[model samples]
Target: MVGGGFAGLWAVRALKSAPVRITLVDRGNHHLFQPLLYQVATAGLSAPDIAAPLRQILRRQKNVVVRMATVSTIDADAKTLELDCDGGNETLAFDYLLLATGATHAYFGNERWAAHAPGLKTLDDALDLRRKLLLAFERAESETDPDARDAWLSFGIIGGGPTGVELAGTLAEIARHTLQGEFRNIDPSRARVRLIEAGPRVLASFPEDLSEKARKQLERLGVEVSTGTPVKDITADGYRLGETFVPAKTIVWAAGVSASPLGECLGVPLDKAGRVPVEPDLTVPGHPDIFVAGDLATLKQANGKPVPGVAPAAKQMGKHVAKAIRARLKGVGIAPFRYRDFGNLATIGRMAAVVDLGAWKFSGIVAWWFWLLAHLFFLIGFRNRSVVLLNWSVAYWTHQRAARIILGGDDTRC
Candidate 1:
């Protein structure tokens, strides 16, 4: 098993009582709840509230061994993996391999833009963004020049996806409500937060009406929503939208993502997004012993639409893979993989969200609460869920984010 994300973790857990021994290898020591990662990027939640150590999680399962290593190369024919760890390089052999590696940000051929506009994917990325965000306000407070101050205060998020929308909304609230009267030099409420999207509408995957409603909700939170405008270039000072260059000190990239490079190590033909096209049973074309899941694997559903790279879909795939493996061991034919459709949910701001459950669709305060409950229910550990709920309760009543401290950055001139 590779990666400690939802797919790999779920697969390992499902095989707990099986006859086979499991070795889960990952670079990170913890399993992160990625859905609420935006809250950590913003100041709403701490790192510990969403992440739990892998070793502690599987302590009771005696059949599994966890290895902290990075997979550098995979020799599929030999069924061996070259791994790099802190101690030294090593090669591990496996009877059956499952690559559940996730994805990272795609700069759309503009790799240089990453330096100026960072995308959130990991705990380090979130912490770096939080530092940058908090320092922007601090720098604005201390600046004397009006133009420079305005530049420091300006924030741009390039994308209208769930992460971009959530960041924009939470940022607007931080400026308009959370940081009210905190700084004497400048009013935090006056900070400019813009959500830039090249597409025709925000949340394009949702219903047109829900997309419009999400746009309105963002606007109500004081976010400057700009659609149908493509960014030409991004620099340290600002970003160019169409013909105009907008000065902003902080920029976030949430436009696109590409799968982990490990897929290429398999020497298989990949889709345009660098994802491995797996068989109906979630196995490699010629190698039935090898399986792929999560963001790394791509498959078309019965409706001809590609299965989404969401948490639920990954969990389902992991569970299915376990079942398939057990059947194969017993010399029984396993059924083809089938994805169950669950509704989509995207929260815009406080008391605002949208949910699409096929026949049933709704938006606003009720959706927001539903979103909250669903996330809480999906969170892995009880301590994490309780702490997150408590933090959320405090923030809800006070309108003040608790984890607002800036740490570990050398430069403060964000």
Candidate 2:
């Protein structure tokens, strides 16, 4: 095991009764619930509500041992991984390898822009954005100049994907409803939340009608939805959507995502996005002992469509890999991995969402309820779910976000 994410956790659980001893190594000590990270960034939820300590999650699994270390290199032929631990390299040899390492934000060759437009991918990223967002309003409250105040209140979100859409929607709600009557100098409802997408439509993977419905829901929340607008430059002032100049205090990059750099250590062919191209059984080509899954592996479906980089798909891959390993151990022929697409769900705002369930498609309050239940059900721990539900209920009724306190940052200027 090389990661502690969704794929890694699922794989470990599926092999609980197996005879093999599991050694899960990761740089972090917690398993994060990634889908709800947007809530943390938008002040709808706190960090602890979506993350759990890894040791506590697997304390009962006697066959598993979790190690905290960063993987530095992999000698594929030697079947050994060099981990940088305690300021030195520690090598571990393994008969079987499962690289479940996930993805990171992609800047598309403009990595420097990350200093200005931070992308929400981790706990720290969420906190950074939360501070930036809240501080923007604070700065706007103090600014007397109309133009400067407008710039401070404007928020530019790059991308119209699920994450981007969620961020934009929640941001609009926070500005328009959550913080209403809280500020004396500036009206939070005046905050401009813009969702910019280079694609033809928002949520491009969903059906055309559902995508349009999601756009309308966002618009209802006071979000400016702009499609076919690619971001060109980002700076301290704002971002340039292609040729258009938009002055914003905070810019969030929710666009492209590339697979982990650890995929390079596999010494296998990779896709354009730096994802390993694995075999049918989710194993490295010609190397049955090693497997790849999650966002790190790029495998296509029967219809030639690529498997989406979502939590469900990664969980399915992890479960399939476990089954394959068990079959190989039992001297049985392994079957090709087939991913099951349960459905796609994205919440727009309070009581607004769009869901695509194969033959069935729905949008509005019903889909919103489904989305809420699904997220609560899939949360890793009961404590997290309870806290998140309570937080959401409070926000829903009171129209107030409780986690708006900015924690840390050197220069707090928006």
Most TM-score-accurate candidate:
1
- lDDT, candidates in the order shown: 0.94, 0.92
TM-score of each: 0.99, 0.98
What's the true lDDT of residue 172 in model 2? 95
What stretches of model 2 exceed 4 Å from their correct place? none
Model 1 weakest 10-residue run by lDDT: 405-414
Whole-model lDDT, model 2: 0.92
Q: What would you estimate as the lDDT of candidate 1?
A: 0.94
